[model samples]
Target: MSSQPVPCKNLHEWLSFLEGLHTSEIDLGLDRVLTVFRDMNIGKIAGCVILVAGTNGKGTTIAAMEALLQSAGKSTGCYLSPHIHFFNERVRIDGRNMSDETWVEAFERVESHRGQVSLTYFEFTTLAALFIIARQMPDFALLEVGLGGRLDAVNIVEPDVSVITSVGLDHQDWLGEDRESIGFEKAGIMRPGGVCVYGEVNPTKSILQQASAQNVDLRVFGRDFGVLDADSEPATETMTDSPVFLAQNSAQQPIPDAPVPVSYQMADGDFVRTVLSEQSIPVSNRLCAIQALALTGVRLDKIDIDHCLSLISVPGRFEVDKNNPKYIYDVAHNVHAAEYLSRLLQATRQRRRGKIVCLFSALKDKDSKGIVSLLDKTVDSWAGWPMQVDRALSLAQLTAVLGDNATNAECLPTLGEAVVRAENIACDRNDTIMVLGSFYAVAEVQSFLTNRANRSRGVDEKGIEV
Candidate 1:
């Protein structure tokens, strides 16, 4: 294959080249990436590295961890996938997206080193992110796994702590059919003799088996550590046999239903209590990130923890627009994430004076029916639009799925039209408009809203006055 001229003009050209470089969108393996990574001699990114893998909550957990570490005066480099707006959002240094020039430089390095080996968009970007982060030599490097843990390109880098946020059946085509099979795929991030934190309440049997076989210092959420309210009993002593105990009682005790100011017990029989202000960010994910980071020898006082956590504002995760007609945006593509969004809606139903109008769409591969059925009761009206992407569901497909559960549905052409239709429906009832489905769905709506807001303020797309 002829090496075409490198797209050194800007980040956009480089990204476009990467999208069409490989035959398939997702080629999940490490051999090709590792070959290029080793050639680049990128070693020991930071003093501590954390690899986060799961069906959901990876982005939010990493965000929380980065914020906490940065709050403690430690420089952090975080690499996340599927940016909502700018490609720069994928690679962040010191909680800020690196400049476009920096990203172009990283991409150039990867292109120069990769001779004939074909790398997918994710693989090439992952390598570039590692290169950029290693050059900065931050105190901590947080890598969010793009796909399944075991064979993902990011897995090529060994992590000090591997965290599995929550395992569910989302990418059945790549990961597996059931939760156990998917759990096994996620468990691939755990290195032997290394520390790992399992954050969800339901610890799958496969995860237990993998942790035991690898002799990993695995920390289960409820068994090894957990959160408790002020009125609850004292922190339970760290269990001796964590995997075995967890296997037997995984479902017995769940995350506390209580509110903030909760005390989180660590694996070493220590407790840290702090009040969390971000209701959108789950308490379990916050505690999981804190516990995982503590194992890396980074500790924060209660006040610092509270301060950092309060500053975390992840986009598209229950992001609210508190204008005249309120709106909530969540990138809940699969059933697992949909469950979380459903619970939040149910809890806040009492405060909503008007109808809950959900503007929703999803990829063709997703379980659109399951998500629609699950959220049917909470959402009084539905507006579906075909997300402008290769894998998105068409208007007919979306309407067909909504037929099963959604009684008041509006099938529209684009996200803007869908939002307008939803607003018209909610205008009479003072309802809230929620944009749900894949990341692409949220991106479209957010871009539209942002541009509209800017136009209303007499500002152009470049942020210049009109």
Candidate 2:
């Protein structure tokens, strides 16, 4: 531990300093973080705290909840993990990224009171986010767990409500190798007598056991609250074809599309019709967010829900490049997400006569083989691009899994080259190019496209002309 005052004067310098504080990138546990939390005396940070955990849908569910709460005239503070572009994206105050000065101030406070308690990169940043949120004192504080809920740094805060979006087989090394074990880890956020809104149709035995042990009010999807199939119908609205990601202004915000209405049966057996932003969101996640917010007494009228959902956009999930409808990007690295993406591709293929080409890469720890195999039937071809990160899967590993399907797969040295190859393959064929795999892969492609768009607009990354 460094006894000298932190040598950082800015957010960038402090981020670098925090990265070296611990040898490992992830050290999941609450004791070390809790000590700092108490030392900092950040008690009662918000009027209501919601802890959300899951394998795939955590970010989407939390984003939905934040949007809904804010629509109801409640202040919201959100903390998300594994940001796409910048560290500032990890912490949002009132639907906007906090300034670099805000981050520097929060880090200084955490460093001063840390008192030799070494924290990992995630722990340090999480503390800084909580400190900032505490100072602002938002009405609703939404915390997304970085990993398994049981020992994650965010678990140090007691939550009024917990949300388990879906339990899947990601991060098996720490959480466990099976769905049952993974469900138990996710169930850690539940408190006795508190409400937990589960999003999936079927609940794993471990989750049920945990909730029963804690005597928690677990409202499950397809049971206590779910989509009212009789009244629910697909919306006929279509999004305007425009570039969703722009490098200029550093705000890749997607424009608001027409609201799609969804009907759901609430816990009281009463049906409510809610309008969500777009059809890209899975109905299950939207239902879970509404149910969780309902437990907190956030009753929103139809118009309010529409307004909020229209303004909400979770990037890197079913993000289509409007300039070329053929180019799509999604951060689907695991089996569950891949299956959903595959179904989407199959549906799109049915509507259009064209081939589906997937540009893919994944982390060494992810189930890349499973994802590729799951989408193999729906995707006519594959373009493998190794992410630039150390944990990214090597070209050989990606090819080894392609195995018998190697004839249909093409490997490239970099993401940019791989994308060029993909575009060439899909050129003039009316085929779709879907970018899938880990977050890093999607972020790289998004950056490439955004830069290309900025250049075409005669503006640099800062929106200044050359």
Candidate 3:
């Protein structure tokens, strides 16, 4: 719709322009992007940039990084993709969404540099994020690769420490069909002499091979460093009363029962075992973030890190919005994530007295069948809806993949309708409801629950008191 180097007055305008800039939604490679990156001349950012790549757990890892870094009083700029609600949430500095003016300026800078190369939406956004981060010069610029790492726009920047959160079968058309192929693509973020951390319990062979060939100091999760000990504390009165999301009150000490104390060893042979009371970030994800931070030469005191853990919050990852019915929302689309969600749901089911109600939707490109298959046994009843997106796997297609269990699955007209139907069928307020499949599904479910919660509080949809 527009030529390179065109000016945009606002963030919305820039986004609209970017959508039609390139012929296709995804064009993976670096030659054209590299040329434009050099034109932007963000060669030496004043701060350190940590590039994180993987199939799942990438968001969780970066979330912990941001919270921990900010807790230590370091200015941080983080770039994430496919936001749930707001676009500004994708780019944050000091844990706050960047203003519209800041994003517009960054987009203009990137537009000014592209000579004749046609950059995809993700590529264009990547450059803009880097430009903004460089201008601010935060203590650390955390970049989450939009897709498979090697040719992804963020890979153009050299990261002091690269982390592969976990690899799985996703984006098979571009990343290959198996874990080996996908791992190689993600490992492309690693640089020679740079440190790389593998957070997957069993990393792919290709990942290990590529990092070793690059002479990277590869830290393996099980061998190099593993979670030694971890135990969960009991819930508190505050949490018991609210039961949805408990914000960290600076004046209060963490409830002894809320802490999920975990022990792990780092590359320095130093053991780091601390309690993460906040369910916002899981124990495994916390370990990944801690290792990445440690690699950055940031000496963290056990007490300090533990204290900051209370402040960590990652939206849409097992986000509990209602305690009575145990309504939880998570963006777990792939098989690896499904396994994690299954375990989480299983544990949650054991603690409660009712069956689980799963409201789900997924993109056609994802392993929708595998994901549904993993959660099928754990879920008692399924309520699914059609996603109004380009790559949405139709209700019929999903049912076919779900196999014999298709008999039990009910498809609704829209995601919103599915949410209502799920809540109605969840037995009562004591039963559990899980909203999963994709970020789109979780986002919509969250809105539904939020609106309902407001109504219950006697507030109208317009935020007016009844």
Candidate 4:
């Protein structure tokens, strides 16, 4: 692939052409992707691949790993799904998005390589991501599973370390309804003798059985490692006003162990030490994600961890826009993620004085009712909109699931209108507005916010009114 950019007459035309490939939105099978991969010779790429699969926390885990590796000064490539703002956000190198010219070249390569086999939208994009990553030849690559790991397109590449962040009731239509069924599908990413890490609070026995059967070197959080708040210490004599904390590892130490006091300046020392000492590879960003990566055997120094954590930024995940009435935008589309949002709202409301106004939209296949039921009581008002996508649930369909309990419910056809209405209803003093449900919703609102910010010129860099 040459650096000379591939000239496209129109970007929309290219996008439309790509979108016209498959009839079904999601067709889970390995045959089509495998054929394309074989033709393109994806297996020849020389680097360690980390395949991350879970109902939720997949993006967070991948982001953490990418940050850690980059901080270690290693060239890293990452491919995540359902881009929040831009299509390029799905693929990144050393934490920066791939150039449009690079994407165009990749698309062209995929088109040529896909001789007789027809690829789905995801399959096409997955190939494009791999093409880009292969060109870079980074030391490490992190691939986030777009769906269940069993037959997802990204699973075409065998990973050295397979990480299942957490499994819950999600993608039930395709995977299964119960935890065991879901766990089995996610466990598909594991290879013989590969390091498998589970971040779930309570992992099912089926997952363990599959790991054992596959002969995977498995590590589970809580059972193998855990994190807790360090005990408070008195003000230091030298610092005059400083609090200290410590991090300990049970595997490295025995019982009746005493916690060490970490300097206030080095608050994340314990996490950094744990990550560096545990992982085989030297990870860079120790502070932001080292704690999470520590469970998988990646380590970093205190300074490196701090730098990585400081540089990390994940859009639409607890992203706050503080205008006169604050707006909290989050991409919590699943039931488990929704529950977490509900807990956040409950906790925030306890300490702050505000009325929570929820603006939600979701795909037809998702557990819309379950998600809404989780936040119904916590929110002061509810507004629903159907996303501008093929699988989006109509407002009427959503209302049916909401039932009689959604007395304050109102329908808005477009996401723009829903956001405006939510903002209008919120008072300047203490009211808060939140946009959740689907990535589509957040993407649309983010575009609106960007445009609004550009036109006003009064908005801050964070896209908030001054």
Candidate 5:
């Protein structure tokens, strides 16, 4: 390692320095990273930590939990991977980005504690986030897994609750080649006597096996507690078509009968209620977070939960920018995420008149073909870009994956140019634009859109109001 002060006298410099170290993109061993943590005495810190891992819905789940906790007046710290717009967005306390001085101090602390053991860029950054969390000593710390759970650096922390939110085929090269293999890796996040929550309705057998072997208290969505309908009202008629039930009994509880056809809003509310109740969480939003927090014995009222859920927001995950074409941005790069996006698009299509234009790109490591094939039928127009990020595929590779599709597929060298082209093509007021594929692609387009919106709002070129 360079052992030098990060450049630019800012948090960005520290991030840049960390990124510059180690040519390897991913080193899945724990010894080197553990040594740095052990040397820094991070394990001795006082805080309730929750580690979230899985192929899809992890970010959304984390955001909901964080928001619920914050609403309850808890001092919260959240660390997310592969930032969307700014590196600072990765490490946040109570929804605010960390300061430059905080980053410098944390980097110095990690460097001082390291004794001969080398750390990868991720390891270094993970340690920094831990250092910040330890210092802040927030009521709770939410750590999003950078990759698979077992050997990931975040595994070092013995969380009170380990949540695996819907496993799928992602990171096949390192985790495994199939769903079972990926489930095993995600199961690594569970600790002895710790509570394990599976957001997926039916997880693979391997995940259950690993949890049983670890003797972790496992909570599966459909089997444990469940959601059911209580009663129907006209006000909630359009919200949900079906009334969901939260069954407390795990054994021999017959599934509830399907409700009369109703509105989409009621159906969604029913689903949310089912999920929250199945997890043994209270009906209120504060309880939504408190359910997860209850594993650690923290209790809060409904008002508190409502407060937290209202304040928390997960960026670039279902974030919509109200431009002329009305861009909907999400960081859905994998197949499961693509499926979710497909559902969202389908729902929007019911009310909207214009075609949905998709701007897509991804790293070479991802299952590009499978993801594209799934999206091919959903999107009306396709714009591809291969920006020079780590392991980003070239335009040729992206075009080859499209393979002469009927959709309007074009290769744009840069994300900025791609967004401009997409906007121009989506000139009609009824059209909607979606930019996705990689977090980097989403971030690049977000910056462009934010600037464009600012310009339209009469903000000066320098990003300041007149």
Candidate 6:
């Protein structure tokens, strides 16, 4: 790094330089990152730290938790990964993305002491976010792991409360080939005597085993806690008008909404009469969020769940671009995420008359077949292009994974080109275009949609999502 580049002066320069620090994009291990943290003298953050890890629902859970905490008057610093639009999206202080100046300063801090330590792109950037958050001194620090928990750089922080959204096969190459193995790695974030919440519909043996081994106070969904799904009217055909997690089952019921007064029931015969404005999120997500908040000693009554949920909308995660010929956006790269996407697609527009076309693409390392098959039953057609990035799967590779379904997939030159084709098809068939697959796919599609919409008005695509 010293031989190749001069000092980085701006956010882009810092990011570019950091990307080249390591030979690989993802090098799993905390020794190098921890060493750098110590060198910078970054002790534990002033606020409470909550570590979130899992295959799916990490973002939603984090958003819910952050909102609940903030609504209860806690200033929060949140760090997430794989930003859809801007790098600043990764780190948020008090529900706002930190400015470019803050990032540049943090990057410099990390760079100064990382002397001989080679950190991966995620590692360096994660450290930078932590530095900024610690300096800002928020009341709460929510860290989302970039990869598996045991080795991810974020795991360096021993969270006071740990949340596992769900265990599934996604990063099979690094995490594991099955749910059991993956659960073990994710369970690494929990410490003895800490309050750990798992949102899995069916808790895996490995997760239970690990929690037991460490003597962590583990709460499992459906066992120790449960979400009393809000009994609300069916979501309108126009998804933009409603906030619903859309049922994942084939029946597409509206999660069998709870009574007029939605309440979350704890295992000990206690219940909190709750209000959630964002009723569209998964019940499991909300349940886990409340449990986490309670575990962290935040008063449930102080949280304006509805107001908080309304304020937090994650982009590239079922992001709605248009209404009529609906354009749904989600970054469902792996099988676990794909399952959630498939259910979301079915549950939302189940009664709508429009056809459903899922626009997709993925990197070479993902489980292309598993991801594709999960939504095949609901998607009317598929359209995508090999990503422009180096790790993108080739058209041939994608076709091979898609198999007989490949006949229905349209291979285009670029995602923007695919966007145009999808719009044309939607116009002809009255279809809803779902932009999904990798984060790159969602970002490109989001960019295309924002650009198209702004052509007449000429404005930068600035989205306020935490």
Top candidate, metric TM-score: 1
lDDT tens digits, residues 146-257, model 2?
9989999999999999999888899999999999999999999999888898887678999999899889999777666554333344432222221111111101123234
The parts of candidate 3 lying over 4 Å away from their true place are 1-8, 229-269, 272-280, 322-325, 448-466
Q: Could you tell me the lDDT of residue 289 within candidate 4?
A: 36
lDDT of each: 0.82, 0.80, 0.76, 0.69, 0.69, 0.75
Cα-based lDDT at residue 5, candidate 6:
35
RMSD of 3: 7.5
Q: Sort the candidates on lDDT, descending order.
A: 1, 2, 3, 6, 5, 4
Model 4: which residue pairs collide?
A: 68-284, 71-284, 72-284, 275-299, 276-299, 276-300, 279-297, 279-298, 286-305, 287-305
Error of 6 at 182 (Å): 0.9
lDDT tens digits, residue span 63-138, model 1: 9998888778899999998899888899888988989999889888888889899999999999999999999999
TM-score of each: 0.91, 0.88, 0.87, 0.81, 0.83, 0.87
lDDT of 4 by residue, 347-382 (tens): 557646788888888888888888887788888887
Expressed as tens digits, the lDDT of each residue in 166-272 for candidate 3 is 88788899999899999999989999988988876677899889988989988766555433322323221112111111222111213234454444444455655
Q: What are the clashing pairs of model 3? A: 5-111, 233-257, 234-257
Q: lDDT for model 6, on a 0 to 1 scale?
A: 0.75
Residue 304 alpha-carbon offset, candidate 2, angstroms? 5.0
lDDT of 5 by residue, 249-305 (tens): 221233223322111111012222212211111122222233455455544334433
Model 1, runs deviating above 4 Å: 1-7, 229-278, 322-325, 428-430
Score residue 48 of candidate 6 by CA lDDT. 89
Location of the lowest summed lDDT over 10 successive residues in candidate 1:
242-251
Which lDDT value does model 4 have at 77?
Answer: 89
Model 6 regions lying over 4 Å from their true place: 1-6, 228-254, 257-269, 273-278, 322-325, 428-430, 455-466
